[model samples]
Target: MKNNFFYGYSKQADLPEKKRLLFTEFMKNNVKINQADSATLLTGVLAPPAAMAAKKAGESLPQLKMIKNVPDVLFVPSATVVALITVRFSKRLFMRN
Candidate 1:
């Protein structure tokens, strides 16, 4: 029960690195920010590389999307933690900008 709850919660803050990379890459190629227009709002888990790329490209991503990132019993602990932090901090930075 606890594990399930944590898994659900974590999905809101983290995503698989490959998915993050692809989502941000797609946005980078498609989103354009103009001063007169409000920036597009995206909610998704963003890894460090994806966030940095989006930042440099002037894209706005608000938070981690509620995407599934299932944690294996013994394999995904550390990566999940890092991804959570990356997504949160990146969202903060994007919001600030």
Candidate 2:
């Protein structure tokens, strides 16, 4: 039987030193980006529904009249920004040693 170039390198530890380092760095960056992207997506998805609920609730309360008058186009971006900042701030606050 003939052996392929990658036949024995099944695990990351089996990779050459330089390649292993590069792979590890790539994975770390990928995970960080994935987490950021997930947060952004979650905020984006939740913002609209939240705005709608607020608008509905505001209709029955004089104190929330400002919420009822705000347009969705403006509300969504602002809500997303606030949500992302909250997520990042809370992570920093609680994830410390």
Candidate 3:
């Protein structure tokens, strides 16, 4: 039973590297300053390369169009603990911009 519960939570489990990737992607993809005109907020795990790329692009990264301005449309490589941070930090995203 404990294992089952733990397994159920696996989707939310995030490796340190995984969290770093998603955070990096979020910082890279969402560079818009205006809430009304910026891309959707993003969060979650990213493929190793994706994160590396995002880190490379840094603050100069471009915006994405897949999701609307809702912000929940994060580009995660897979499921992770990022949901919590993304859910709340979604609003904080544009502030720095």
- TM-scores for all candidates: the values are 0.25, 0.51, 0.20
Question: Which lDDT value does model 1 have at 80?
Answer: 45
* Highest-lDDT candidate: 2
lDDT by residue (tens digit), candidate 2, 56-82: 777789877777678878876777777
Give candidate 3's total backbone clashes.
Answer: 3
Residue 69 lDDT, candidate 1, scale 0-100: 33
lDDT of 3 by residue, 3-53 (tens): 343343455466766656665666677676654323233333334345445
Worst ten in a row by lDDT for model 3? 36-45
Candidate 3: which stretches are off by over 4 Å?
A: 1-12, 33-97
Worst 10 residues of 2 by lDDT: 3-12
For candidate 2, give the lDDT. 0.69
The collision pairs in model 2 are: none
**What 10-residue stretch in candidate 1 is worst by lDDT?**
35-44
Give all candidates' CA lDDT scores: 0.47, 0.69, 0.46
Higher lDDT: candidate 1 or 2?
2
Ranking by lDDT: 2, 1, 3
